[model samples]
Target: MTQAIDRVRQALLQAGHPDTIAMFAEGTHTAAEAAASVGCSIAQIAKSIIFRSGETPILVVASGVNRIDRAKVGAALGRKVERADPAWVEATTGFAVGGVAPVGHLAPALILIDEDLLALDPVWAAAGSPSHAFRTTPADLVRVTGGSVANVKA
Candidate 1:
């Protein structure tokens, strides 16, 4: 496994998560690709989106079928938020934009999970590499990341 994948595995294990990371040769870089690979609905994919509230990084794990409402996010944070550039995302999360996991970020972030994800029993998230992923529940995501569930869907 790559170092990025290893870090994600370690983080999952430390958090007592039961599933192991799965690497796909074809890659899981997009939500559509990930859902197709995993044989699940698009909504079951938890896509981690990164944003910046000034110098602080924010992670929003939203359902793949939904688009995030930046206004709602800003309301929640009580501040304006902007999309993080690729370099900033990598610097803050220790993973590239396409492979940022819900947990195991390099720096602490205010994480917000879409409440819609909670309706799904099983969810998939990126595992620190474009080709890696792991099965998990929304509740597990909240537990591992210490994130709040909100109406993040647009």
Candidate 2:
């Protein structure tokens, strides 16, 4: 495995996940791409969105079918949040835009899980690369990220 993917596997192991990483012959960068690759509903794809809440970085794992509302995010945290740029995202999360995972970030990040994701049994999250992913429950994502569940969807 590549170092990027290896790190994710190690982190999941440390987090007590059941080791469910899967690789695709083709890239699955977008939610639609991932869902098609895994033959699951688009909503089952947990799309990770990182934002700049001032100096703090926040990772919101939301359902693919839902649109993330920045107003809802700001209301939830009592502060406005904007999407982080690619440079900031890579620097803070140690991964590029398309493959940022919910956990194993290079630095500490405040995480938020979409309440809608909890309705799904096996949510697929980007592992470390666009071509890599892992199956997880919404509860597992919450537990691993130590993030709060919120209505982040519009």
Candidate 3:
């Protein structure tokens, strides 16, 4: 398990992202759990959510502080945004739903970032493991994940 995490970290580095990844014994399956483990506000955690915009998969890195504004998302993209099922998440990301990272996925997705994350300097994100997470700036995440800054949240 540690070796797998190391690989994920290496992938992040190879992708030109800062290597500030951290692992923990407790699972970061939820924002509250991650906030407790990382000792940060729950709002600082970025939830890597996969939603289906028609047949295409769009990845939304939303702030833990707010939920996605489905109507706004639909309006911006011109398609209805339906929350992707767990199976779809696994299929698209190669990682489980709760542990999905913004990068190193099995398939590329249309990425939209929560503009609110910009207010938080160092944002916590999943690290390809349920028990691991990392802190990095939202701008760096956008660059590393090839995501665009957008008003993805309500």
RMSD, every candidate, angstroms: 1.2, 1.3, 2.0
Q: Which stretches of candidate 3 lie over 4 Å from their true place?
A: 1-7
| Residue 139 lDDT in candidate 1 | 81
What TM-score would every model get versus the actual structure?
A: 0.96, 0.94, 0.89
lDDT of 3: 0.82
| Residue pairs in collision within model 3 | none
lDDT of 1 at 73: 90
Candidate number with the higher lDDT (1 or 3): 1
Q: Using alpha carbons, what is the TM-score of model 1?
A: 0.96
lDDT of 2 by residue, 86-131 (tens): 9999888877888888877888888889999999988999988888
Candidate lDDT (C-alpha), each: 0.89, 0.87, 0.82
The alpha-carbon lDDT assigned to residue 128 of candidate 1 equals 93
Candidate 2: regions farther than 4 A off: none
Per-residue alpha-carbon lDDT of model 1 for 61-105, expressed as tens digits?
999999999999988878899989999999878999889988888
